[model samples]
Target chain A: MKMAWKEIKKSKAKFIILGSIVFLVSLLTFIISGLANGLSMDNAALIKDMPAGQFYMDENAKETYNLSKIDEDTEKHVHKEYPDAAAFSIQMGFVVDGNDDQHSVSFVTSTESDLFENVNDGEIILDRSMQEDGIQVGDKLTNNQYSGEFTVKGFVDQKKYSHTPVAFISMDNYKEMYRTNHMQLLFIPGQDKAETINGLEAFSNTAFLDTIPSYSAEQMSLNMIIWFLVIISGMLFAIFFYMMNVQKIGLYGILKAIGVKTRTLFGMMWSQMLLITAIALVLSVSFSHLFNRVAPDGMPFDLGLETTLQLSGLFIVIGFIGATLSGIQIKRVEPLQAIQQGEM
Target chain B: MTAFTVENVKKTFTNGEIEEQVLNGVNLALKEGEITALVGASGSGKSTLLTIAAGLQHASAGQVMFQGKNLTNMKQEEIRKVRAQDFGFVFQASHLVPFLTVEEQLLLMLDVSEKRMHKQEKKKRITSMLQLVEMEHRKDAYPSSLSGGEKQRVAIARAIIHEPKLLFADEPTASLDSKRSQDVMELIRELTKTLHITTLMVTHDEEMLPYADRIITMKDGLIV
Candidate 1:
């Protein structure tokens, strides 16, 4: 350990370059991961905030939830079989507020269940974010598809879909607007395994989220970028360590010649790798968390502690594996080589 | 008394399908506390024999006996223990660790040799070794800052810090000029006598041969 540290102290510039590269790569991965997670939430907060469960949609809908139409009779049968199950429908529509400005919202209506907000006919409950846009309780709002104006009942928190705030309306209003009495999906909460339903396909909560149009593609692309960055970081670390090892092959030979145990030589390499990686992780974690907190509200960026720790752990593993793999140099060195080389 | 022996050691190197016998069945012994220098021309296998006897490399055939144990039959780890605890080396190049100070270089030697002494005692040993090499004034100097002569002095200090039973010097003065070479050779001779160490040295310089008690000349892989 002491020898390793002394080497680093003597060769500060080489180690500093490697450490800086690690820091930049990790920080970039962290930030992109944060954005991917945040965007996922933005795109599907309503379903994500729900308890773990199974969702059922029409089997012929071809895995597209919006195209799914669960027959009213089948919905009734599911509710009967799973007493706590709820039937719900979602559609994109615009509501005109008192200012006569149109705002897009995911219109939702659900059968009577504790999972959804309840409303009498002609009354509407909206996501609380609508309040920022000047919509208030008892305020009248209109939709071109519905003949009657809705009186805003209240607002719910974090109810969203398709990157838009959700507006909960009566079943009658949803039926009138979409011109369909058939609900799109049936939800049964707290199910470990989804049970098969007649004429419908079963999906877990996460699988159902993927069925949302553009949700999987957007998240998949962003997640791919994050992984690529991680892989590049690992490769970068390995190449740097290999280069450093090649440069020190002669030094290793000399150390071995002086009766240093091969194990001690390995210990020296490990300690150096650990020290460099630790410093880089500390810097990147601090900066990533700092950015997480100060990011503008308009930007969808959320870096949770769990994700940060996962990535940090991954980085350490890769760095360790890389350095250890590069230790072939130490093992391959011949003490006679020390007699060959005149200097370090 | 024979402290170390080399019996009919033959080493063959194969490059592609062509085989070259570097050392061909040669035998010799070194008396305890005596300096035996092997002087030969280039590629005469003097250095090869020295390295084989020091346990730095293995001979393809025959035995290297040190203290009644055949090094050729020992496991790698076992040979390593012998090298660490009983053998020391001074190469043509100083081979001082570039990152370490002169003092630390000696300390590392003590550590590798597994010397069981208190920290203060080890420090004292390092100080004494440095003083013997006339490098005590530059204990804190790095290898890079030292001149060719100074680095060789530090290297000599590191070699004997562990008080090994045998010392192997492979052209230890080759890197220095005439004056520095004489000084370094004098230091090696004096230290081996004081420590009662059996020494095997390989050198091309005829001038340094007089310092050894037994000067064996080699040609074509055999002592002539």
Candidate 2:
């Protein structure tokens, strides 16, 4: 083990090059993984934390509950029976501030109930991302399409859907502006026995969330990008390691001629790869955090410990497989060739 | 008794349809504690014979016995073990690993040999081996920093570090100047006598012949 380390240390330049490539690949992997997780969070943050065990939506609503409608009378009937039921209307659209600056937003209107408790009156709650658009408290933002003027009240941490920031408002105000007689959805908390009330379709919260248009599409798109990046990075790592092993063919021959077992040579090569990959992963993760700090607002990225661990495990496994595949070439080396070639 | 015996050794090479016989029915015996020189012209099958004896190559039709065990009947791994523990070789070119210092090179041989030694004991053996070659002071220098003659000396120290009974030297002094060549041959002879090692050296340098206990001259793959 000591001698193997010495040999690797002597070839520091080659190892550095290999390490750099692996680091770059690992960095890309980390970023892509973060993006995938961020996209999922951004799309579901509003509903993920909602205090509802199940939501009711029309079965024929196609992809989104926003387009689905249930009557006020039916909502009231379900509330009377379940006692914890709540009804809400959701609208996703764009709004222009007084300065004519257009910003994407998700508008939610909830009845005064625990399930709809996140909603506040004429004051609109904006996501922190809206700060970049120069909107602040006391500033008026309007959506002429919805026929209302909204006051920027305060900011929420990360409430968003489909890349748009979300805002909460009262149900009456929502009804006056959007001019709809029916509520788009209903929420029921811990009332699995609630009978099907008139003029409303019943669903579990998980099912209703999936019915949001662009939720699956958005997730699929981000996941595809993440998958592509992982495959590309893995292949690039394999190729770089393979080339380095090929370059050391002569050294392998010499070691073999000196009666070093093939298994020992394999152990050295694997250790070298693992050492390089571990160092590269650390560097790449550090660089990723540094970049995240300097990035401008709305650049979606979310790197959690879970994601980091997953990517690290992936790199180690891929690196080991790559090193093993490259090591197959060692068996082809003839010890006699080293004797003929003059050892350096 | 002979340390190694070769009987009717023959090696033939075929390129496409043409066949070339490099060695034809060559018989030889290498006795213990004697420095035997094999002198031959190029293409006289001398290197091939050495390779066969070292178990680095297989003979077309012959038997090579090292300590009365037929090398031809041994498995590949078994042959490697024999080479590792019982045989030592010095090539025409000094084949020191570039990454290892002179002392480390010698220790590497001891590490591979089946014989187990403690770390301190291994270090002491390496130190004494280097001292034998008068390279004790240069033990820490990598092969790249060494002069040609010094590299050859390190190579010799590495070869004999495991104290193998049989040593094969194929043109060991081929790359050195005349003075260095004579010094290397004398060192080889002295080490063989001091360690009671049987040595077979293949050389074309007539000037170094005086150091050999016996000489076999060859031409056209036949002993002259």
Candidate 3:
């Protein structure tokens, strides 16, 4: 093991080149992974913020949340069965500010429950993102279909739906504007097994998120990119270590001739790999976390500690497998062949 | 005393569908504290026989007896144990680990042989061995910094550091000039004599014949 470190120290340039390559690849992976996670949060932070639970919709709505309308009877039954349940409806719409600027939003209305923001009639709470568009608390916002005006009451952080800021309005206000009395879904918090109710389809929080029109497709593409990067980094390790091991074959054979254990040779290779990867992962993790803090407001890039740790662990394991796979040559080395080949 | 013996050793190498017999019915005995040299032309199986006897490769048939143990029937790991603990090797090239210093090379050999000693004692032995090879001045030098003769001297130091009963030298001086070759040979002869270590060496240079206590010639894969 000391010999391994000494060799690495003696041949600094070779190992440094290997380390820098790993660092760059891993940094790119962490940055891209952060983007994927951030975009997912941006797309559906409204439902994502909700506690783990089950969502019930009309079985006849064909798995689309907007088209699903739970009957008043089913909503009442769910509320009776689970006191924590809330009935809510979301519709993509636009509000016209006092300046006549039209702003797109997802108007969400839910019955009185702790799970959602319940506002009084004619008062609206908007996602903080709308504030950036010049809408402020106490500002009177109007809708083309409503007979009355809405006064912005407050703003909440990260409340978004379908890539649009959300506006929380009372059920009566929602009914008056949309001309509907039926809620689109009934949510019951903390149900391990969703009991079947007549004419209602139950969805886990994750399953319900996927049923959103573009959520699955958007996430699938981003997730595919993340996985592709992970696999590419893995292959990079394999190919790099393979080349290193090939160059050391004669040295390995001579070591074997002098009676060095095959396992000892493998230990040397693994130690070098671990040292290089640990340094690379540390740099990338630090830089990625730093980027997480300093990224621009418009850019969604969240590299959390858990995600960083998982990716770092994966890199180490992949590096081990890669270096070991390349080291299969060490096992096949014959002392006589190396002797015949001369100096390494 | 016969410290090592080979009985009718045979070795055949297979390359795809073709077969080549490198050693055929070769027999020999090596005495303790004696230097026995195997001399032959290219393709005469001297090197092959030496490697087989050193447990570097397997023979197709026959027995390799060392101190009453039949090494031919031993498992690969068992043979490796014997190779590590009881045998020393010097190849044609210095084959010093390019990354290690002259002193560190011998330390590695001691490690490979698993010689149990205190750190201070091990350091002392390395110092003495380096002085024996006249490489104590270059103890801290990496192999690349050493000339061919100096590197070969380090290789010999590494071989004898563990005090093994047998030393196998395959063209140990093949890569050096006449003066350096004579110096290396004289060093090997002196070390084997002083340390009471038996030596089996392969050499093609007839001018180097005088250093060996006994010389065996090979032709067409058999001792002649």
lDDT (tens digit, per residue) of candidate 2 on A1-344? 36657877888898788888888877877777777677767887777767547777766776368678876677777778767666777787777888798888887777667644364556677887788778887788877755667777788787877678887776766777788877888888775554465545666656666677777787677677766766665676677667866767777776776678888888887788788889999999998888668765667878888888887888888788877876788877887777787554
Which residue window of length 10 is worst by lDDT in model 3 chain B?
A: B76-85
Shift in Å, residue B64, candidate 2: 2.9
Q: Which residue pairs show collisions in model 3?
A: none
Residue A165's lDDT within candidate 3 is: 89
In angstroms, how far off is B151's CA in candidate 3? 1.0
Please give, for residues A221-265, the per-residue lDDT of candidate 1 as tens digits. 999999898888878877988998888888888888777888898
Docking class of 2: medium
Number of the top DockQ candidate: 1
Better model by lDDT, 1 or 2?
1
Model 1 regions lying over 4 Å from their true place: A120-123, A131-140, A148-157
Candidate 2 deviation (Cα RMSD): 4.5
The regions of model 2 sitting more than 4 angstroms off are A47-59, A64-66, A69-89, A94-103, A109-117, A120-155, A170-176, A181-243, B217-224
Between prediction 2 and prediction 3, which has the larger DockQ? 3
Question: Could you tell me every candidate's TM-score relative to the true structure?
Answer: 0.95, 0.83, 0.96
